[model samples]
Target chain A: MEFSSKLLENAVNEMSQLPGIGKRTALRLVLHMLRQPATQTNALSQALMQMRTGIKFCKSCHNISDVDVCEICANPNRDESVICVVEDIRDVMAIENTSSFKGLYHVLGGKISPIDGIGPHDLNIVSLVEKVKLGGVKEIIFALSSTMEGDTTNFYIFKQIQDFDVATSTIARGISVGDELEYTDEITLGRSILNRVPFESSLKL
Target chain B: MEFSSKLLENAVNEMSQLPGIGKRTALRLVLHMLRQPATQTNALSQALMQMRTGIKFCKSCHNISDVDVCEICANPNRDESVICVVEDIRDVMAIENTSSFKGLYHVLGGKISPIDGIGPHDLNIVSLVEKVKLGGVKEIIFALSSTMEGDTTNFYIFKQIQDFDVATSTIARGISVGDELEYTDEITLGRSILNRVPFESSLKL
Candidate 1:
């Protein structure tokens, strides 16, 4: 816990401020940086600072971007009428990796967790409702996780846009393709059974 | 793994370069930072940059310091006649926490390891030998870990200063206090048995 140098202590303290990193881990990381060339530290700090200060969010989707508008939002080929609602940019990237969804995304930045003091007003809910109200959008798919916060946020957003003429749906909850049914949680298994689709309809995909 | 923004990717790439951090963890950390205020990122980067660029090493002992001479070396109360050789500043801090030894420390920065391409020339062995040759030091204690690399580094330094008039010794290798003999590793247990000290000597501490 005792540091020989104040500078070393400061660096370790700052590094430990990050989530999941402890003081010992911070010390190891800072020492690693010290052993490396100055340019390495320079690049790390410079890149972090640049990301924090220069990063932008798409005005339409609220996903992280380098420009005023992200490529997905700016792409004319993508369908803007069906917006997939999700937690953050990571979800956008995850959905994009599948290449199955042709619709655009609406990044909520985070779920509405009152335990963490985050509310509907703190997220990108207003902007999303604004996008829906502007009227060309038809369906809004709730693509958030299955957690309580995800469901709460989904319901909250659904309520906000319920008066407007828009179809609402949620991403299907079922056993993953390669997962064993025996290992599936009871709630998920029950939901999968209740929401079962026609076999012929499944083959169409 | 796919990044929507180049700046975000750069930050994640740079963050992942730190020891023990992988790309997924790096992305998690970078996203956590993005969720936080800009000031948090600024403070972390500023602290790291300051530590890297402004850090100094003690001229005498090679321990990290904020000044030309470190506090340990500059302390008049510390016995400069005896030097405790260690691997890094962390070792110095550990020994200091024990509050048992009053001798000055000589940090070797790292131990000799062929696998890692570290050699005696890469350490601070020359300066330590120089201190002994100047003829005021009485003893040199090797306080490195009991690993092969640690022993190699110790033996390498011992050969360099064997002709000098100073006495030499190593920190005792034994079962730690409060450790059960049955749970101790065979090698350490065997060494502890062979190097057993007198009953009276054990009572002194």
Candidate 2:
């Protein structure tokens, strides 16, 4: 669509370049901003610029943080000996929201997807291995997805630390808590049956 | 959801305040931005801020423009005697896209919505009346939506210009061009039948 203003056209072009936003959606968003107070737009732009410019990642875990060391890694209450390995910061946030895990995290940044030209080297796997090799980690839990790329990365990292004294495990794969048994996919159902826990263990939760 | 970084949280909060975006979609967009080069984020923020800060409205038509008078109002080719009144710049853009109207536009900024506390004073109706009062305009076409608010605003503006000699008209409302008759709403279908044009006029098109 033709825009009368060059500035509006430029802003819409930039907005539509984002992942899921299309030209129509970008226009709607731009028009919404125009209707609101200028201060609202100012706040949004300021927050985005400040976040992009001032953001940092945790030196140890590689999760996004406002400081050199993220809150999870720096907290003394979290068990540093048990590290949960995951793909990115969003995973870290999801796990943290559960409040079930009391351990630290190792963010791999991304899986080993060869189709996208992203290999193990493109991730933060080397730093994770170095952290594990330092030898205080009692157990490294693989919390990546069940995709083939996730499995490959997990196996490669497990090999790198196999000779170390640390024990290795993976997060359990099963049907989601609220999912129906008949609707569950075959692979997940099979895995759930194979990895079934004792009845007494299930009662504990 | 909890975020490790305050800046990230702030940015997401601001982004999600937009019309259709929710927390999950906001997180996905923010994560996509984080994965891209810092320059992309910088460009987006810069363009948004610049557009909001430096944008101007046309003095004559009130259409958004980079100059005192918009390109349409300033163009000698456009018919200054016939003014198309619209609710906003988007409507003007829509009408322009048709490539049929060569008349100047008068943007009302918004419709009259009592539920939203918007009235005639909140719009650019006075300037529109003044344009007609200046005595060169021969006709005023109301190109607003057929909503109740749109109709009220049109009537209010019509009353203001009724004392003048200029003719007044509204855009024709009926079944859409390619709509199926069975699925068309009764009000529109009835109107289409009642307002049917002469067969010779139809052949002229």
Candidate 3:
């Protein structure tokens, strides 16, 4: 399709690269953005640049943070003895929004997908095991998706940390299927987190 | 909802100001934008800025253009004697995408919505009438939406040029209902354009 201008084309191209956005939706979004004031557009542009520059993975939990440790990991009131493990920063936000979870978090960065060449070593699994091995942590909750990769990662983490005294668990699975975690609302995700089951005994086979 | 950063908050606020985007969708879009490459983000930003600074409405047709007149209006092959009247530049684009219509276009900028304080004066209707009055225009096709506002605008335009010998018509209403012209695909829009009927003379009251 012939675009109105070069800038509009560029904006649409960038927007279309997003996960759910197609060319038509991207065009709609770009047009919508254009109708806004210049300050708004400038703010969006500045935010994108600043997010890349200022936000870094927290050294402790690996969640996106401005400081060395993320807000959840740094908070003294949160339970340090229990760590909820997840695949990305978005999961951290999801759990945080519930206001029910009192524990800290450890982001694995990604799951072990063999097809995508992401293995246990490629993730932050070693650090998770080390954190457990240090001996103060009482529980480790796995909040990975219900995909094969998530299952593999969960199993690998279970095996690696079996020697430790830490109580290992995985978030409940009944609410999710396939590659659908991205579609799950916060309430469903929160419910899954709340009903986590012991993983070592469940996956012993 | 607590945002991770000020920049993120600003971007979300800006996106939420758009016609259809809610705060949640805006946040989702901002987060999605954050995952993109710097070059893509930069391109989007550049496009937004450029769209604001570079694009101006065509003097004759009111279609968005970099020069005095849009490409369609400036083109020699387009039928200057037949002016297709549309609600906006996007309607012009929808018609142009068909590649069947050889006529030029006149964008009204918006439909006549009395509830929204928009009227014939708010649109480019006066300029459109002036263009038609200048002589050689044989047909003035009203390619507006089927909404009440669209009907109102169409009637206003019909009244403006009733004295002239130029034939006035409206695109066929067979495919859509109420403010749905924006959603109609190019093929259907093209068909509608081709099957337009002359304004009923009895409804002049």
Candidate 4:
């Protein structure tokens, strides 16, 4: 059926475009926005706008930030000796929330997927290697997903950094498979971090 | 745990403030946005900003619109003589979605809730009465909820228009109590419209 207003229809269409939001859910959200006070609606609008205009990927870690370097990278107190490699900024945020990780992060932007045309060169792998070669990093934690692509990316990174004196480790995949690291709850994530094994010892590659 | 960045935290906080969104859902939405292409993220942000800056309530019907009069109110094909009185614009959209009602709408803004300090004057009741007094109105279909506040508002409107010759009617309350008109599926809504009873005759108030 045709919607009452084109604007409402447009808003719903936009909302439905997002992952997990169906047409019905989008409709409900749009209607809820209509019921909200102008101030609240304005705040949501401002936040959304600011998220795009104000934030950019950090040059050092590839994590989203309003400045050149992310808060983690800019913080001098954080350990520069350990670099946690993640597939996305969400994974970095998830790890940071635990307050247990005092190290810096390296967001690969995405996992290496041959079918998806995402190769090692497509990621920030070169920058990671360059950072490692600069010589302060002692450990490289592969906090990527346990998927095929994640494994491929991890193997490629391992090959590229074999010459470095840093210890290479992958976040434990004992109980996690077919799930993004970002989706794993904090408790599970913390456990996984503590239970992580040496990549060379576990993968034998 | 504290968020990774202030902007991300702000976005999450604002999203959580939305009606049904919780902290986890807010985080999911933010992460989803982060994963999307720059253009898609920009579209969402632009839509949110435009929803406030471009949209305004139609003066004639109080429905959300980009122009002064809503598309429904401005449409010449709609039956201006038949006015559907509803609690909100969402109700108006619900009715319009059916394509069965070609009538114009008068949004009461909200129902009478004295406990919540919402009196008759707090609503757009005066404007509704003025519209009825202008003449040429043949019917007024009250499509309010079955709640106490909805019933009270219906009664007040019924009393005010008792002197007028307009055929006063109401959408059927066959659905259960506390059921919002917006939440009722389109098929049920259409059926309710088909089986609507005369307000004055059925209630006998």
Best-performing candidate as measured by lDDT: 1
In the order shown, the candidates' DockQ scores are 0.82, 0.79, 0.41, 0.35
Docking class of 1: high
Once superposed on the true structure, which residue ranges of model 1 sit more than 4 Å away at CA?
A200-205, B203-205
lDDT of 3 at B8: 63
Model 2, B1-205: lDDT tens digits are: 8899999999999999999999889888988888899899999998998889888999999999988899999999999999999998889989999988999999999999999999899999999999998999999999999999999999999999999999999888888877899999899889889999888986753
For every model in order, the TM-score on chain A comes to: 0.97, 0.96, 0.79, 0.79
Candidate with better TM-score, 1 vs 3: 1
For candidate 2, list the clashing residue pairs, or say none: none
Of the two candidates 2 and 4, the one with more favorable lDDT, higher being better, is: 2
In terms of lDDT, model 4 sits at 0.81
Model 1 alpha-carbon miss at residue A193, Å: 2.2
Q: What is the lDDT of residue B53 in candidate 4?
A: 53
- How should the candidates be ordered by TM-score, best one leading? 1, 2, 3, 4
**TM-scores of the models, in the given order?**
0.95, 0.95, 0.81, 0.73
lDDT of candidate 1 at residue B146, scale 0 to 100:
97
Q: What tens-digit string does per-residue lDDT give for candidate 1 at A126-174? A: 9989988999999999999999999999999999999999999999999
Write the candidate numbers in order of decreasing lDDT.
Answer: 1, 2, 4, 3
Worst-scoring 10-residue span by lDDT in model 4 chain A: A170-179
- Compared with the true structure, all predictions reach lDDT values of 0.94, 0.92, 0.77, 0.81
DockQ, 0 to 1 scale, candidate 3: 0.41
